[model samples]
Target: MKNMVEIRWHGRGGQGAKTAALLFADSAMSSGKFIQAFPEYGPERMGAPVQSFDRLSDEPITLHCGITSPDIVVILDPTLMATVDTTAGVKDDGVIIINTALSPAQIRKEMGIKGKKIFTIDASGISKSTLGREIPNTPMLGALIKVSKLLDIEKVLDDTKKKLEKKFRTKPELIEGNLKAIKRAYEEVKGE
Candidate 1:
């Protein structure tokens, strides 16, 4: 993640794919890194397929385009791996982080993928247990950091906690839940 690390996120509408990218960027920015976080919207609707992109680097990013070749592809919605070609433009040595209850071995076999690395996490489970809902964005953010080492985990937690405090001001309880979600996911993420 030193010089332009590209990432692509796959998830369904309203599932926090866009937020994950932004949170990643914001955390990187807090650590003095340059980042771009934006989504590719297409006929958007709740539960519809969605994709977001992120680019983090030590230097300023000049290119302004969707990520065609990502170093890491994170899938928050396991179902998208069925209908969408999630790995289409990933680099040969790319790492894929999928939010699934299944293990990496099972996922790799099910997806018929080879060569590239596949990382799996029960993000939905973590979020549901910690946040009282099935939102996997924050948890997935933790997984992304664990898998890619793109940003400092402490910085991400610090920045994200501050951001969450502002967003969920009236619901402070949710803040702790989200923080727990991130930490749990980071520790629980399994790679292969």
Candidate 2:
């Protein structure tokens, strides 16, 4: 593990990016690592742009600050590609995880992104095919875990499953489907 792992999340207001960051923080905490997770900006209304951040370290995390140069950038909404610069300020070796069907090469070429390791997953496709929803944050998080080596996939799934249990508990059939989405995403990403 590096000295620290910083993540920048881009998503629309109701896309669960903030929840994803918090869930990732909670999951990393379960791994006994110290972490900081929070959202930037105020009052995110539905369909509006928003950004969230997360930092995880083996040692106790003391710097409770917003992420500037991120080690990993997760794009939760593909539409944001035209609206925001998602790859700006990322570290040279940083990993960018995007929720799109586009290949890494295509994304790099289209976006003209120069630095960092790029990983792309059709998270929306996975979510729609497996969970019947457009929310791909969980699947994307699983891919992030695999690519960035940020957290133990099993631990993340365990913690995230618990956190999401309430919503799917009533529809017991959906639980397994969601888990499958996460696993599928973890397997799909070819990280650099």
Candidate 3:
């Protein structure tokens, strides 16, 4: 990984963008890295577009503001790409990971962005099959880690399972589904 990596996530209010961001940060921290995870809320309502930011570095983060230019962008809600410019301040060669069934070529053309590295995954499909829900944030986290190669997958999974166990002590299926969704997405993400 680079000295520092900034990730921006785009998703609906109800989706797990905030949770994914925090989990990524926490998991990465377990690997002995400095991290910051925060959410930017809009209207504080469900289904409303929202953004979450993460800063991961080998050194302590000195900045405490929004991430304008991200090294990586993860889109759990592809519909947000139509309304929000996910690449606003992103580097021209930055990697973009989107949860969509569409091909990377199709998204590139639709967004009128060419040459930037974009990856697409059927995270919604994976989530439906594994999580029994349409939420794709956990899966997107898998794709993010796969493409960025910042945090080790096993470490993230360990942290995730520990966290989920606290929230779902009696529900083993829910935790398993999340683990399945994440691992499936990690292996299935396609890049261009």
lDDT of 3 by residue, 1-192 (tens): 459999999888889899999989999999999999999966868888889999999998988878998989999888888898878888888989989999899899988886679999999999999978898989888898899999899989988999999999999999999999999999999997
Error of 3 at 140 (Å): 0.7
TM-score of 2: 0.93
In TM-score terms, which candidate is top? 1
Output the lDDT of residue 41, model 1.
Answer: 76
**Model 2 misplaced regions, further than 4 Å:** none
Superpose all Cα atoms of candidate 2 onto the true structure and report the RMSD in Å to 1 decimal.
1.8
Per-residue CA lDDT of candidate 2, range 1-192, in tens?
457889899999989999889988888899888888999988779999899999989888778667899988999988898879888898898889999898999988888888788889999999999988888888988888888776788877787677668877788767777788888999998544
Error of 3 at 44 (Å): 2.7
Separately for all candidates shown, the number of backbone clashes (residues 3 or more apart, or on different chains) is 0, 0, 0
lDDT of each: 0.91, 0.86, 0.90
What is residue 150's positional error in candidate 3, in angstroms?
Answer: 0.4
- RMSD over all Cα atoms, model 3: 1.4
Candidate 1: segments with Cα more than 4 A from true spot = none
Candidate 1's TM-score reads 0.97
Distance from true location, Cα of 64 in model 1, Å: 0.7
lDDT of 1 by residue, 1-192 (tens): 348899999999999899889889888899998889999978999999999999989998988977999999999999998999999889899999999999999999999997789999999999989989999999999998888887788888888899999999999989999999999999999987
**Candidate 1 clashing pairs, residues 3+ apart or interchain:** none
Clash pairs detected, candidate 2: none
